[model samples]
Target chain A: MHEMGIAQQLVQIAIDSIPRDIENPKVEKLNLRIGRLASVVEHSLTFCFEIITKDTPLENARLDIDVVPVTVHCKSCDNGWEVTGPVFKCPFCEDGDVEMLTGREIEITSLELADELKI
Target chain B: MEINIQKKVLEANDTEADINRTFFKDQNVFVLNMMSSPGSGKTQILCKTLAKLMPHVRVGVIVGDICTTNDADRLKVTGAKVTQINTDQFGGDCHLAANLIIESAKQLGCEDLDLLIVENIGNLVCPAEFDIGEDARAVVLSVTEGEDKPLKYPLMFRVADVAILNKIDLLPYLDFDAKLVVDNMKQVHPHLPVFEFSAKTEEGLEPWLDWLKIKVFEKTGK
Candidate 1:
């Protein structure tokens, strides 16, 4: 339900973060780090990104996404594991008191540009 | 050749949520963000819950909708401060961000209240990804919906602190299996407590309130 709006945000944020001191900045790629636990579909985001970036500075920008997998730490046992599915329980200790380590990030890591560009 | 921005896509929203978290802590208010799909009986459950929760704890609610204050109007009669936020004016988004919640809560004077509940815009996907500076998150699933919803939307189930299996009253008339849903919910997040109850019948509502009371006390330390 939100790929379109989030893509719009991605486009705006990407364009705003570009260096303005250069003459005719041209963006080539937008790198994104998304968590597996995050509710974002890579295909949907790519589709939305292409549509919103049309005619904008990011029109030719390729979306490079890195899917971060879910990892958790068991507080009771001090055990950590890379979770493959939806289960968050501590497999070693059966403790439910677990904290997520890496699976909730939703951020723009960097931008590859041919030259300096304006959004 | 490249610029390292390392910025969050929802930086504005995250900053606002951080500000809201600080304000909620300063105000000593325990906040809960409740989410569900449309027609999950979220309002009906809230009405029943407020009726029982208001007498003991000072509660406030912010109801969000696409165009109307219908949910807020229903919640106001419980004597708890209630406010309605229509997302239509704010780009008509499918989710309620913290920037909107803090404004509505402050208008309700939530600083004086012991508990603040935000009935998030009825959505499973977008709302799950957005944090509204809440101490706890709850997801409501009715018997009318698919049992595999937890598997389909693992992010929502994974993020929720608790799950509510609503509409047990309709189980006899439908093919939905409550146990399977509970199992599916646990498969996604084993730690979350699931409450099975029918808001219409007022059955199984007490346990949820008890859980809420404990959460409020744990956070407010009162």
Candidate 2:
């Protein structure tokens, strides 16, 4: 699935962003903010991440993910509400023209690396 | 040491994409990144398009798929220079990233080409997120896939410069509301170009081909 590709990209990003001073810093944790509308399977991403990070700096890293819900702003009613399900219609005006404010994000927010700089 | 790396994962890909954009500009080539779901008839449309434009323009293709060279083989029959990249050999990639595309384009000798059509792996969501330095992005949607596709996959619709509703010939057999699909797409990307055409019977392809020619000529001054 696409999750595997995204996982690979995340690992690459982590590897590339490592500070030069940290001599093979052991990655402890990786946090990602994924949205429901991104159509990514979080379990699949985690599974793929584990496989992709093997023997790398992130081998033992814990993958943390936050599932973000889609929020829509109704243009007609000027109302803001969370998309309560797969249905994207506005609750107030029953309008589908609501603009999407959030969701559709697939970002790696932060990484926790072993403090090799102190040693 | 917990170092904070607030970097976008796709930054590397974007850097490669910038290189591709500059390369295309220098060569005066118009590139189109075609995206769609599996079984959306992307290759078929390419076949028809190549047939129509072969006489008027020089066209080349770089086809990406998870496995198999089936689409490339099909396009080769159209007498266009074609290159195939089976991303499975790399990592079973669902979408073609900019670095991979640039590598493939170089292998295909795209510098001499006027237009490069990149048939991205047939997955709507992932491919829409990646920018491959194409002059235009075309999202192909067939009538059998239902009308709510635009609403369900808004990112693809919103990112695409053109939405080609393929397989209009099957409209009589299927209960697909073409108008509803257009309306939904317009809601997301107002003023987006929508084209209804059938690759099988060669119906409604003239306007699309014409628009494509105009775009290529405008971009390349050819």
Candidate 3:
């Protein structure tokens, strides 16, 4: 699954983003912001995470995912709304010329680490 | 202590992709990433496209598959420099990542070519998720696949800048509504450019080739 590649990246980013001063850091939670348009299966990503993070700094890390919905802003009418279904027209002005505001993100917002460190 | 580090999960990939993009920009090579199902006639269409694009535009190809250089072999007939990346060695990746593209481009020598087309691994879902440093993304949907194919896998068409409906020569034999398929794709991506072609009969290729030429010119200014 491609999620395996993404999961590997997530774990790598988590480890890389962590401060080096945190001695013998133990990961407790991983906060992820995944948009609806990313097409990543949450369960599949979590499963891959479990395997890839086995011996890494992210081992046993609890994943907290926040799914972001597809939101669009109408360029012509200056209206914005969340897309509920396949329809992409602006709700207020019914304009089809719209720009996607969000919903394609796959970001790691934060990492929670245990306070009990070796230092 | 909880660390409030906000960063993109695929930042590493994005960085590599940006570097590749700059490399292409400096080299003046327009890269197209083509995605589709296993038997969607992607190689055949590329053969036809290369036949038309070559002699005027120097074209190169990097094809990704789970195993074998079969597609690369087929594309060799067009005389374009073809590089085959067998993902089986690397755990059989379903899509070509940016790092892989960078490696392949180095091998293919992108500096000498005007256009470098990446024939991605034949899968709709996986390839859509990864950006392989391509200037444009094209997804081939054959008539044999079904009109509702876009409905089932919206992300592929949603991300595609262009959608090519191949195998139109068999349209007279099959009970497929081409209009509905186009409509379905438009539903997902309102402004997405859709091209219909029959690689067997060589019909409806001019627009596609012209579009590619325009893209190449836009990138290379040559």
* Candidate 2 per-residue C-alpha lDDT over B1-222 given as tens digits, one digit per residue, 9 for 90 to 100: 555766656666778889999988887899999999999999999999999899578899999998889999999999999999898888687898898888878888876678999999998788887889999999999999978888788778867889899999999998888999888877666557899999999999999998899999999877
lDDT of each: 0.88, 0.85, 0.88
Sliding window of 10 residues with minimal summed lDDT for model 3 chain B:
B183-192
Clashing pairs in 1: A25-A116, A25-A117
Residue A114, model 3: Cα distance from true site in angstroms: 1.8
Task: Tell me the fnat of candidate 2.
Answer: 0.42
Q: Candidate 1 on B63-139: residue-level lDDT in tens?
A: 98999989999998888899999989877889998899888878889767999989998888899888888999999
Docking class of 1: medium
What is the iRMSD of the candidate numbered 2? 4.0
Chain A TM-score values for every predicted structure, listed in order: 0.91, 0.91, 0.89
Which ten residues in a row are the worst by lDDT in model 2 chain B? B1-10
Comparison by TM-score, 1 against 2, better one = 1
Count of backbone clashes, every candidate in sequence? 2, 2, 0
lDDT tens digits by residue: candidate 3, A54-84 = 9877889999999999898878788888976
Instruction: Give stretches of model 2 more than 4 Å off.
Output: A16-25, A35-39, A55-57, A66-105, A114-119
lDDT per residue, candidate 2, A21-77, as tens digits?
Answer: 667789999988887777688778889889989999999799887888888787778
